[model samples]
Target: MTVLVTGGAGYIGSHMVHALVDSGERVVVLDNLSTGFAWALPAAATLVEGDTGDEVLVSRLIAEHAVEAIVHFAASIVVPDSVADPLGYYRNNTVNSRNVIACAVKGGVKRFVFSSTAAVYGNPDAVPVAEDAPLSPMSPYGSSKLMTEIMLRDAGLAHGLGHVILRYFNVAGADPQARTGQSTRNATHLIKVAVETALGLREKMAVFGTDYPTPDGTCVRDYIHVADLIAAHMDALRHLRGGGASATLNCGYGHGFSVLEVIETVKRVAGVDFPVELAPRRPGDPAAIVASSEKARALLGWQPRFDDLDTIVAHALAWQRKISAEGR
Candidate 1:
């Protein structure tokens, strides 16, 4: 049976595709080229250029490929952009997802893995945020994703849809093989922006808000390598396929790196000291955010391989060099 990956052409989704393909699983990818490119896909999987919300296309693929599972990754991810366009965020992240799930149910897909975000637990008072933390999303993007999580829970109860909701914390790094990375046109993730600045891809990058009561007076985020994070998803898929209960687990290293520390790592690894401006904090940015991934570890028996900050930065830097060389 094939595994269907929505938004499989994008950064995180593409890595998941790689992981699935290497495991000798038949794979089908559905992604609109809005922010995704066909070039990011591995040769082993078949790519279908279409919207996840397209019921006919999604349903047909599930049946045609005998798809047994799905990993939903397509969404509008920018916090500030989601703020400026809440309706657009809700429509794509929520409304479109509804369509995908509806198709999954109709097709009787056995397993589902969702690409949720840490933003759902906005401004939590706890560090190493647990799965049961109070969810107070501070942005439309987060709220929309939270809505989908709720829908999945309700649908599971009503339609017996088994699922694994993975709440990701600041995914970074690239395919260790240097195949793909954060290819977004203008990504604002702290690490990506910092790495690009080190490569002279941009003149400078700002450390958003240095008065957030953090150790270095900057925002702190738990950054997980994309490769390791996808490994967690693979484990989640196995759990679900093996009749494990639906789980909402965090995908993070359970620790964090402040914005300053990350920039320092990039500078140290790239062997270049770039310019950084200390700017006011951006809205919807939590002062410090980590995760309690103990459940993922105990349940999935997953161990991380790329947990070091330097290794993450080095992989990202390599991808940046490729991007610059290819002029992509």
Candidate 2:
């Protein structure tokens, strides 16, 4: 069976492509290269440069490739950027998602895996937020992803499309083989920025908000390794293809680390005391948002191998160093 991965050239998506190819599955990548690099994808996977919202292009690829499944990862992900341009977020994350889902259903794709986010929970009332937690997004980025989940649910009910919506927390780290990683220029991920600073790529990194209710007074987030996150996706794909029912699940480690803690881990792992400056919190940022992930574990049988903060930082730092050496 063939799998179509939208935004498959991106960080998490590229990892997914590599995994699929290694498993001897035929893979096709549809990406616009807006925030992704074509070189990030494995050469075994066919790369079709195009927009996900382009109905004609998407439909053509689906029909021609005999695609049985689609894993969507294309979106505007930066929280601060989403706050600055809510319309753009909605257009990219919601409207474009609608078009992609429509094409999948129209083209008779049997299975779909959606890339949702933990931001949909907003500032949860409690830690280790479950999948059934109240949906109250604090940012347009979160709201846009939530809207796509709704569309997927409704579409699945009306049509016979099976789907698994994986609501991810803060995804960090890189591929263990050093093949693909978070290489977006000017990225906003905390771990990515800290790794960059540790490698001297940046003079310093900013610690946003040191007055939150957390122990370290900085934001606390559930940082899941990129490889583990992709493992969850693979499990979800298997569940869907095995006649399993459609479901929404949280993908995380069920624990969190404060910003200060992550910075310290980066320093310890990389042996670099990177400069850090305290800065006011950006708009739409929650103080803490960790995932429960019980549903994913019980249903998808996901087993995370790299749950340690230091491991996550080390992998991220290693990838950053590789990028620097290659002068990318």
Candidate 3:
């Protein structure tokens, strides 16, 4: 049985693919190459270039590869971009996911691992937001993921499809071996931008929203390393294959760093002080949202290897230097 990983060429998806292939699992990747590069994947994992909304193509891949599981990571995932284009976000994130889930059911796929986001718990009334936090998403990106979660839940209940929904916090860093990392050129992730600025890839970086109700007056996020995030996905796959029940779990380090702190860390890691400007709040951004990942740890037996912010920054800096040198 093979694993069908959607968007397996993207940053986090590529990491998952490397892990899967390292464990000797047969893997097939489906990506549109819109934001994913074909070079990011290992030769062992076959890449089928296409959109997830193409039901005919997806169905064919599922049947052809004899896929028993799907690790979905295809979606548009920028908060402010979602706010600017809600319909686009819905069509890509929600509607395309619906097509994918339907394909999974029709093709007899047994397990599914959804790549979700912590944005679903928009502006939680408390810190360390748990799995049971309120489902009031403030952005279209979050809402689209929530909609997919609903569809997956209903599909599982009605069709016996085992699934796991992992709501991720801010995913950062790269593979420790420099195999793959966040290579998107126009990425809006905070750490990526700060690293770029420190490396002189960008003139300077701005701090979005400094008046938030946090200790340093900046938004706080729980930044989990990409490798750790993939570990959670692997655990979820094992649980599902073992006939465990479907579950929604948060994937994070259970702690957060403010935006300013993250920038400082990037500076310290890169040994450079880039210019920093303060900017107004971006739309659809929450003040602070951390994770309570006890449910995931208890249920999936997940153990995060890289939980320190400075370590995460160092790995990211190394990857940036590599990519910068290679002109990628």
lDDT of each: 0.92, 0.94, 0.96
- Best candidate, lDDT: 3
TM-score of each: 0.98, 0.99, 0.99
- Over the stretch 22-130, how does candidate 2's per-residue lDDT look in tens digits? 9999999999999999888888999999998899999999999999999999998999999999999999999999999999999999799999999999999999899
lDDT of 3: 0.96
What is every candidate's alpha-carbon RMSD to the true fold? 0.8, 0.6, 0.5
Distance (Å) between predicted and true CA of 266, model 2? 0.3
- In model 1, the runs with Cα more than 4 Å from the true position are none
lDDT per residue for candidate 1 within 166-231, as digits (tens), equals: 999999999999888999978988788998999888998988898888899998999999999999
Residue 169 in model 2: lDDT: 94
Error of 2 at 37 (Å): 0.9
Q: Give candidate 2 regions above 4 Å deviation.
A: none
